[model samples]
Target: MKRTRALLIAPVAVTLLAVTACSGGATDGAASGGDKAALVIAQGGLGDQSYNDLANAGFESALDATGISGNTIESDDVVGQGEQLLRRAGQSGVNLVVDLEYSHNEIIGSVAQDFPDTDWVIVNAEAEGDNVASVLFQEQEGSYLAGALAALQTSNTDDPRINEDKVIGVIGGTAGVGIDKFLVGFIQGAKDVDPDVEVLTAYSNDFGDPAKGQQLAQSMFEKGADIVYSVAGGTGAGVIQAAEEANHYAIGVDDDQDGQAPGTVLTSVLKRTDLAVETLVQDFADGAFPGGETVSFGLKEDAVGLTDFEYTKDAIPQSTLDTLDELRQGIIDGDITVWNVVTDGYPDFYSGS
Candidate 1:
């Protein structure tokens, strides 16, 4: 856990092959103490207390429990430095590599070929290689449930937080497919409940700027939006804060953030990046790494879903929870189909994206 960082190398954009299991490992016989791994932090960096932090938690857990040694590499310029870092890990003989940055997906594929012995994990998107395992979360599936809950509560006058308006909103950190996945599913679920519900959407354009997120969320709240779902990583923290200050609702993503502002944060769209990291490390140690396959974590895997709402469960009636359970089952059984921007394309409402 306390080791010197590998020396920095001048980064190059040279073409490389898809990485993973190219040969053996930096240390073979992982259970026998030859296992070690590396985790690449995403663009927003760690301490956002959301995606990057969760991924690091998993990597740290694997290091502690598996008796394997590893290091977490953080970079302000992840895209510019990603290639060099991957190559560095391979050359250092690190047995496994896990990359959390979405922008690094293609780079991982191109670089994996150079390190046949290293097993690599790429999150949020797919990459192909004999030794590469792609981890993707079904974010849309979780967002749909969040939308359903928000829409139900938006029009209720019983709770102080509830307003007279049937309007809900969502703010994304970016306008790309990644965040759109959450927005589309959310809109679909809201429409499923109340076809006339007015749903507003916007982009923060930055994941780590809480001030900007707060400003955007406050604007939505002032416009009669009673609840908002934030897919804006660290930026979403401000959105939650805005909900707290305005006595509205903000649903969290990637982690259990209901406790962030107590009653203000309705629930979090759970995406288990930690479980993915821990499992992949274990699989590599056991020599069962499924390289070249995109493994998706969805409702069936319990990887992407809504939280138990421990803080606000009493506010949500049994009927609402029962409906959610029915929807959940229908989704798992194919009876209820949630819109996925990644797979199904953008919906009619957001055709401009």
Candidate 2:
């Protein structure tokens, strides 16, 4: 039974999908003479249309491309059950485990010690153990470009969505170094373009609540913010919906969400989780997994950036588009440095909270 299958597990049910391209099975383990992988879905799970789903897409692609057996593990309570799920995967002889949940960072080092033969990859945060690889993304870099573009577009009266006020906004899922990594960069970029630009900020405190997202964004809109960037995961869908309803603009995160609501979404800050997962899986299959190393993906690696503005290209001014390109190149060339909240702490411009 050499089938490439994905087992999506939830609290009450498990869904399985099968394909015939792979030559391995997850239960066979790494010592079974074939490579097998599993992706532990983060809190919001697969339908996020954002971070979790993006990583899963990469996982599936990698399995197909490398002919490795793989499975996707999900849960209704992923945050609370992360450790248990991970241990089960290791016990089942899963060769590689890519944990997408950020909360699992602190516990992964301990778990990796228990499964020395199972290679591990954790996102956003680093952990100990020689078998673990940490994948980090320079989210602030792409966010800087998003902020600059939003600042430029805020007062452009030509675009009907733009208001006369030089105001924009950002909604984060939570107030922490992880989420602020995007917020601080956006503030810096917007202020660099226009010091007086009023960049409103708020935290939804929940990544899976669209109503909360929409409420916060709508309030910002009422306060004259025509553009709002969503740093929340699944909640970002509500932000886009608010934009469309208010005839304003919303900037998406993690995935290419421009097409999600067509013209309503100005652009999306791509975190490139898909590429990261795919690359890691391929490396594992080739016995080149960068175990004991922290791999960074940023603008230089084409792992993070703004989407191509597919639906809103005609709506954006050429000068504004050109500015984004220049800023992008400047960051890549080290001529411009986007502040990293994850490492640099809160700046005076914006308190992370």
Candidate 3:
């Protein structure tokens, strides 16, 4: 997630009663004086055009359709303020709270216990509470498609833009279980498409540093990598820049970044944060909220996909596009099973372990 540089309000105390009421089952309706709700944006907030933006889009749509007025609260210091902000939302008489913070799962779980009457929604991570609904995206599935696309584009010498080297690369924010979930899927997809395809991998170790991202990408480019995919958050901006300067293709993550640099960005692995948020909010408004459940969205759900190769479409050959479409359909039809590094260990084909 991309963190925004915005000013935020100080945390305030919340009453326990307010929290309890919000987490409970829905009241009678407008006649019952049920409280409207609010969405607590993750640390990244808005303008990220990625996770936060998707969540906000859904929040707005849901509110407009349900006639449920709501506000989006942002916090620069979300880690220490999870309980405080959540409690405050409850105190404000908000019936439902949509939380986008990845690190606040445990905190939300803790606070949900006290506010059993209020419904809560958290994304990307799971929290245990009857009143809390967790949303997780199948990022690896989309990444697999991106890897397949990169593999196809890397070796097409007929295209002047493509280099002779059949090498692709990935820059992750860190070497953690979460980031590796993307890496493992990407590598598996590449090899699945072309068993001999070369995959160069590295981790920037910092999600916030664009400079490191640039340097890492530059190094990969020098090593004959013709295309690179970035799973690093803001650091990915640097990867896009490196591809532009080196005249190589760069794949973006989470959002549609193809327009970030016309012709330079091949595509983006889009995780639809917007859909998840909208569904949860609508459910709350309809009094059908599924508390204590983790809602999982994957390629099958249209929650993850590759962005239209807007600028690069003309550059990509028709045959390559056909191949991509085939792979996409395969994944959707259950013919292709992408790896989930977090749940499943690295496959024997990739790890050779």
Candidate 4:
């Protein structure tokens, strides 16, 4: 069975209790023993239109579906106060705590042991505890598709957005395996299609800084890259803005940002954090919590993939779409393997500090 725990594991750490709903009365089919839950938003917080927001949407949906009373915690110092936040939630009778901060991986294990009655979830990294459930996504797989798509579009001079240079770019929020998982996959996918394709890489080092994201992306655009992929959370907003202003193409991550800039955004690499949270809530409510194992979501589970080119579908040639479908199926069938930085460490094409 898939891993389950009373807790819903999510990425990023949160500090403050931002949104709270009344615990007045449970609606029908509410979690009998786990009525109260807490979702710890990541460092980037909401309005990211990317990672955090995507998770939040799932969280809200689950709450309504399960009729569970819940609140979301957000903090500027999510990393430093992750433990405190987890403890506070557990003490407050929060039966389930889903932490979206990757930085809380180590601290959550001890926190879970202390609050044995409370279930905990951590995303991106695993924590040891029978009550803790770890959730991971094969981000690399979806990234490969995004990379491949960008590769095909980069040199399509027929499209006004496509420049003659066979160059593309990817911007990461930070330099680590968690974020690098997306970058390396994109690089590999791009190279697989056109070994001669040039992939530029940069790090904004901040998940919430749009200015920094825009700056780095602009620099890449100046360097002959027409399509840029942003894995920088809220900071990616800046990257998208830069792409629009520069009339280049930007691939969004974690969320469907195709509408953010109708034609400017080539596509978005979606990480279905919403589905993960929803599954966790339902599992906890149904008394089917799988506490000691890791629950993973990938392309097969529809956890990660590219947007349907909602806005740019017409711009993408039918052959390119067909190729993307084949590549996606190849990974699902195990015919193609996308390098996983979390399990395999770094690859030869890129290194992190």
Name the better of 1 and 2 by TM-score: 2
> Any idea how many clashes model 2 has?
1
Tens-place lDDT per residue, model 1, 96-134, is 889998877888988899888788999988888888999
Candidate 3 residue 149 Cα shift, in angstroms, is 0.6
- Cα-based TM-score, every candidate: 0.91, 0.91, 0.85, 0.93
- Sorted by TM-score (best first), the order is 4, 2, 1, 3
RMSD of each: 4.6, 4.0, 5.7, 5.2
Residue-wise C-alpha lDDT for candidate 2, range 30-53, written one tens digit per residue: 323567788888866678999998
Candidate 2 runs further than 4 Å off: 1-32
Candidate with maximal TM-score:
4
**Candidate 3, 1-353: lDDT as tens digits:** 11223234463523111111112233334213444777777644456655667677777766665656667776655656778888877877778888887778888998888888889998878889999999988888899888888888887887766788889999987776667778888888898889888999998876556788899999999999989998877778899999999999899888788898999999999988888988998788767899999999998899998988889898888988898899888988989888886678766755410
Which residue pairs clash in candidate 3? Answer: 19-115, 22-117, 22-118, 23-116, 23-117, 23-118, 24-116, 24-117, 24-118
- Model 1: residues with Cα > 4 Å off, grouped in runs: 1-30
Better of 2 and 4 by TM-score: 4
Query: What C-alpha root-mean-square deviation, in Å, does candidate 1 show against the real structure?
Result: 4.6
Ten-residue stretch with the least lDDT total in model 4: 1-10
Worst 10 residues of 2 by lDDT: 16-25
Using TM-score as the measure, name the better of candidate 1 and candidate 4: 4
How many clashes (backbone N, Cα, C below 3 Å) per candidate? 14, 1, 9, 12
